[model samples]
Target: MDAIKCHNLSFQQGEKCLLSRVNASFIAGKVNLILGQNGAGKSTLLKLLAKSQQPSSGVIDWREQDLQTLPLPELALQRAVVEQQQTMQFDFSVRQLVSLGLEIQLGSELVKAYQHVADFDVVLNRILQICDLGDLAERSVLNLSGGEFKRAHLARALAQIWPLQQTAQEQPDFSGKWLLLDEWNAALDMRHQQCFASLLKTWCAQGLGVIMVVHDLPLAQQLADRVLLLKDGQVFAEGDSQTVLQKTTLENGLQMQLQIVEQSDGKTMLLPKF
Candidate 1:
């Protein structure tokens, strides 16, 4: 069974259709990558799948039930979203901020204690390590680098999933959670990108589904199982990364001349030859 199934799902803002009759299924233990240029409604599609806004038509089914019918709390427990923009208005510490991710699944005590513990800090500590934010844990949010803050947000979402993972096993037949990361790659440098890609693949291996809206096509090619290419508010192509993101198709749909190239180190790369 598909983890997420969308049938004829469309959305609109009054007269303008942001998406049109989109049908696709997200499989378990895979990263479904959605790609498009700006204003191509990439974020809009993510919102529809996340059930943040009701679709204008069609249906979104998650784990056999209509997604709209699932209460917000149930949805929260089933999925976590990290949006493209994460400008926190609060002055919370980095550790305090990352701990916010576990608030939904975990209780109040350790979640709060996540902020100050220099020893045996549990989930917060674990995610700090996972997200590569260990050194920035004690820093004030207002003083962090942009990339650092994004990593903290990512850590929060990771903490949300990993710690609660044990409980899901106890509750067996658990409809595993899906991580929806929108433009999550924006701030990462080369090193972090590789790290994040590795982490995502590992998460999927452990039974979580990852659906990401990524503008970076090469990364998507390397990491995605399914690539959905959106253009002018419609699905231009949807299939394996190798098939849908081919040279001719990408060039016309994405309005850029893209060439698949091999690097000096012999690793493959997708760069615009234009």
Candidate 2:
């Protein structure tokens, strides 16, 4: 019943139409992957859904509540966004940066009474461990390597909605909680990428809705419960992983011939057919 519903979603800048009349719904307890070739509006859609950009002509409703009507604090509790760009002008340690996720308007008395402080630490610590930032918790985020910086932000976004059930109860008006990411794993190494995938799987299992823009087709297939393939600023194909990931759709969406190979281990690999 709780879901993000979009209607006639369109965004424009000057004369360019980034997105046009898009309609879809992203439900909880699932990993929704958005895939498209460069400039196909995948990142733009994520921004609109994250409320970082206003849709030119559309409505985004989170569990029947219009997204634009919600307050900033309420929206922050309902959704956390991780963008592709990472930057911090000021010096701040990883732990301090991650702790900013707890800046919501919860009463101190209620927080203490509900045992939120302890639960918050549990969520924060787990995110740090998952992102492999326990060693760098004290390290300045600005000085960390690119991969480390990316992981720190990932941890922060997850921390924003960590112990999601409690946060939902604390902010009942924001029931359709979501984690929105734009190419979040683009900077990670192979091992870290796999680790990140595992971490997201664990969160989705706990009823957290995840919508991410990704370029890795194999990774998308492996993790996505649903896939939305965009082309020319519109929905080219959308459905379960198996339905939207066909070779034809991949070729059409990407504008290149691709060879899909299946391994003995039941994994699908995408190869450019030269």
Candidate 3:
């Protein structure tokens, strides 16, 4: 199965447990949203799935293969992650930073050797356009506004797992590739957020798998195919969005009084009562 599975997953720092016995399966080619209040271990679980932090106990499997056994380079090709915070020490241009993702896909040495190849330029240009960073390609990363910087990083991550070898006639296949995002909408404005939602819809339909940790319930309600609710480092509930995001389940899990309103357009809206 092309899926990410966690079994008895737990994480701790010293004596403080951040996650406890988390077991879940996220299918490929779908949007999976993790929702919770602050300090609910949402980011912790995302880190574990990205393999950036090892679980103190239990295992994570990618396509039925043990995550720990995969080589770092191979894993890099199969997955890309965008964290809540981004920091850069060097003064690299947005184009340069984004190119690093391509370097990971095709070795740095090869990129340095053939930096001006036609195919490389094609892929990079497409990614820049998809991420809406074409105009900022040459801008210094340090000079970008918060929203611009976030989009730049998103473009880079997308470049990391882009199907570079596929010919123009071949359909893009992202069956084994995964994108893990943590608070990706933090700096993005409403317009950009909508653009991102549309992009995810298109990519997921083309076999891209996405797992994101977000606090935006309304956006999650619109984008998620599967929803996982975490509370106090545990899975309070999880299932298809329609099944898990009911009024009572969300209220109990998030400790908030929420109203689910049905619009004339036949869309559901989640509103929190103050």
Candidate 4:
């Protein structure tokens, strides 16, 4: 079954329809990539899916349940989001910040808030390694670079997403965890893209659903199981990576020239050498 779904989705901002009648399905255990030009409603769609903004039409169905049927806290327990920007004006250590996902109370002048969980350390370490922030775990978050800080925030969300084994009534099965990672690779170099892709590959294997919005078509070609191409607020094409990442749509969508250079190694790549 599809992990997350949008039905007749549309969002309007007064005189403009940002997105229109869009229906999309994101599969579990696979990397589903969204490709679109600027102003094609990629970020708007993500905001709707994230529940940070309400859709002007249609609905979001997470798992088999309609998101409208669930409360905010329930939705929070089911998904984790990683946005394009990681803006923090406050100072905090990377370790402390990541641990905040464990429900640490905000410290006040009267009393310092503290909460402890034995599982937090394990999860934090695993996420730090996954995001390549293990060494930076002890560093102050305010001192990290854009990419480093973004990875730290990503790690925090990943840490929260990591499954825990509790003996009680069994916490909600994260087998339904919807990972909405948007523009995570925009600021990183090629190497970081590969690293991020690798982590998505591993997490999906463990039943995490990844809906990644990316502009790097070549990387999407290499990493995604399927592709959903958005053009001018509509779905221009969508299918297996090969079908959706075709030469024609890739060019038309961006109104730019491209050439599909086929390697002797039986690999095809799109280039702007036209």
Candidate 5:
């Protein structure tokens, strides 16, 4: 099923257009990766999809419902967004920051009820464990390393959609939810990146649709089930990984000389021209 559909979407700032005539469909249970050069409007496209910015023209639909028309609370229940940069002015603890999702999703009364029965603490603990933030739960968010902060925000995003209150008696599933991520792996080392990738795969398996903007070509190639190449504020190429990610497409879209190598294990690697 398609989680989101963008038709002839365009965005502009003053007289300069950032995205023009963009069309795409993000499918459920798949990782939709967007790639582009620095000023190619990848971030703009993500903001548009997340409804943080409105398009100058065209339409975006979530499950065939008009996206812009949905109430903010309604939209929040169905989708979560993790932006490329996050700035917090307050000295919030890491655990408090992650718990914000519960506040947003379940409100005080429901969150309290869930904690009473299912134990939201247990749920939060497992989330922190997966994001590798178990040890830093009480630390101030301002004191964390860059990688740690990113992982903390990722846990928060996941918490927004995770059915934390579901017990063994309830039917367990994650369906009709979407995660829009912008450069989520930008701060991570290889180990954390792989850990996040594995977590994303598990979520996708449970039917969460994810759309991410990433600069790491090889990592994108490895994790994306589908890819969209953006150039000059428009889609340059888009399709399955093997179709949209290729030597010629990357060279043209990124305006760089690149080499694609096939390893003995049949995995592809992308390297820049020397």
Candidate 6:
């Protein structure tokens, strides 16, 4: 029951229906990838999950609790979201920006109280290292390259839900924590992509639940435990990765011929057949 479940979910803008009756469940402690062409309501569904936007109809439940009824302050401690486009108007340093995520979870007052604590520094430093932002920690957010900026925002989100009270020797329990990402790999190069992919797997192994919207079919095949394919704002296919990411299912849902190559390691690879 520790999952994100949507029942008959729908979203509308004027007369346009962005999503229609999308009933889906994404389990905890695994990577859930949402795939679709543009306008397939992928971003809409992610926003709804993040509670950044309200659905016109239906219910979204987190661990069998109605998401809308949860207090925002309480929810901030349980989940974090990273969106595709991030714009910063201020000249805060990378460290400052990442610390703001902790502030959101702990509130301004608690942040001021804990800013100098060893635990706070430990959590912040670990996130910066994991996100590859340790070197850029003191640099102004305005000066970062696209990839670095993306990593900074990701570090911030991680800091939001990071377990702050755990001892250094204790394994951090990420159960009930969720990370919602939209196009998380967009600005990263191949090296960073592989690096973050490994990091995601490690975190999920530690009980972090991830729901991501991505266009990378091969990456999804590599990481997804569950895959949801969308078409025309509806659930075209939803199941385990091996069941939902087949060549025929992808071709029909995406309207293109794609090649699926089975590697010697038993993993699959996808390629566009253009």
Task: Tell me the TM-score of each prediction against the true structure.
Answer: 0.88, 0.89, 0.95, 0.89, 0.93, 0.95
User: How much is the lDDT of residue 108 in candidate 1?
Assistant: 49
Write down the lDDT of every candidate, Cα atoms only: 0.80, 0.82, 0.90, 0.78, 0.86, 0.90
Q: Quote model 4's TM-score.
A: 0.89
Residues 1-274 of candidate 4 have per-residue lDDT tens digits of 8578889999999999999988988888888888899999888888888899888989888788887778776676667788988688787988877776544212233343554556557656765776788788889988998888877877777766666654424433447777888898877767877888887787788778888898776778788887888888888777788787778887887677888888889988997764
What stretches of model 2 exceed 4 Å from their correct place? 105-123, 164-176
Better of 1 and 3 by lDDT: 3
Tens digits of per-residue lDDT, candidate 5, 131-198, equal 88889999999998888888889889888887755773554367888899999999988899998898
Model 3 lowest lDDT segment of ten: 108-117
Candidate 6 colliding pairs: none
For candidate 5, what's the RMSD? 2.4
State the displacement of the C-alpha of residue 148, model 1, in Å, after optimal TM-score superposition. Answer: 0.7
Worst 10 residues of 1 by lDDT: 165-174
Off by over 4 Å in 4: 102-113, 166-174
After superposition on all C-alphas, the RMSD of every candidate to the true structure, in Å, is: 4.0, 4.2, 1.6, 4.1, 2.4, 1.6
Model 3 per-residue lDDT tens digits across residues 7-101: 99999999999999999989999999999999999999999998889999999988889999988888999899998998987899999889888
lDDT (tens digit, per residue) of candidate 2 on 1-274: 8788889899999999999988888888789999999999999999989888999999998778898998777788778999999789889999878877754534336454455455666566666876799999999987999989998988888777765355523422223568999998899999999998987787677677899999887788789999888887898988898888888889988899888788899877777788
Worst 10 residues of 4 by lDDT: 103-112
Q: Model 1: residues >4 Å from true position, as ranges?
A: 107-120, 165-175, 263-268
For candidate 3, what is the lDDT?
A: 0.90
